[model samples]
Target: MTAPASPGGGSVRPEVALAFAVVGYVALAIFGLGMTSLVTNQEVISVPGLGQLPGIVGMTLSTAAFAGGLWAAVRRPHPSFWGVPGAMLGAFLGYLVGIWGAAVIGGTDLAAATAAMGMLATSWFGLVVLAAALVCAWSGIALVRTRAGRPRWPWERDDE
Candidate 1:
């Protein structure tokens, strides 16, 4: 069998990194919103530790998506430092889209939605973006440290 390709060489192209970051963040936002709505729209008994389930689920999904995006970006033959900035931009834009969508669905005008959500909600959204950025950065760094190839399983033979 041919040997695996090397991980380092050309850096990740800006356009490719941006595209991946945007797609990943948007998908994460959509999934998070859907999960939150599903959990909160239903009336169920309040469990002691389950009160924050929706928020937890949303955060978890977003974090996973951000990390996955970073991993994919860095795994490109030409991994670059641009992935971190791309991730931040994508996270901010995706959160904006989520806010706009929620406002539209709630039958509120943009101005009214902003007023309704108030400063605290806006701050929370910012926090979410920050968290996603950090996750993406961490993932990118980890990927950069590793070799590019399918990991060997314990049950698999050393020789391919």
Candidate 2:
């Protein structure tokens, strides 16, 4: 929504544009996966062991959805390759806290909730989160690109 090329914003910040774009991509990805699951009548996504905990799966999935976008918003603005990952990690910790609070409020057992966090951190789900973060981080970087240097269609390449 904030891309400089996006209309009506008057040169909006690159980071903000990246954030918006990343979020849009993430949403589309999830929607597509959901649709695919519906069409096939099968589970295309799973959380490994977290699914057994009461509300943990939902909370984790909900937080996992946007945490990377938060990281990407700050990341591609400038490639602070070092600092950005740390910030991304902080955002992840915050997500865990949010999950904890929400789960407890929702009356999920404290031990179960705690265990769920442990399982998530140690499981392949952690890699999934990291992969998601990387995807979100790189995607917005492309939006700021002014030109595509690769092969173009006939009309585009044969400009008058």
Please list the C-alpha lDDT of all candidates, in the order they appear: 0.48, 0.47
For model 1, how does the per-residue alpha-carbon lDDT over 37-101 read when each residue is reduced to its tens digit? 46556322122222333334334444555555566556666676666765565455444444444
lDDT of 1 at 73: 59
On residues 23-102, what C-alpha lDDT tens digit does candidate 2 reach at each position?
Answer: 65455444554565576565432323333343344435444545454444434434333433543464346445655555
Q: Which residue pairs of candidate 1 clash? A: 10-78, 11-78, 12-78, 12-79
Query: TM-score per candidate, in order?
Result: 0.44, 0.51
Give the lowest summed-lDDT range of ten residues in model 1.
42-51
**Most accurate candidate by lDDT:** 1
RMSD of each: 8.9, 7.1
Clashing pairs in model 2? none
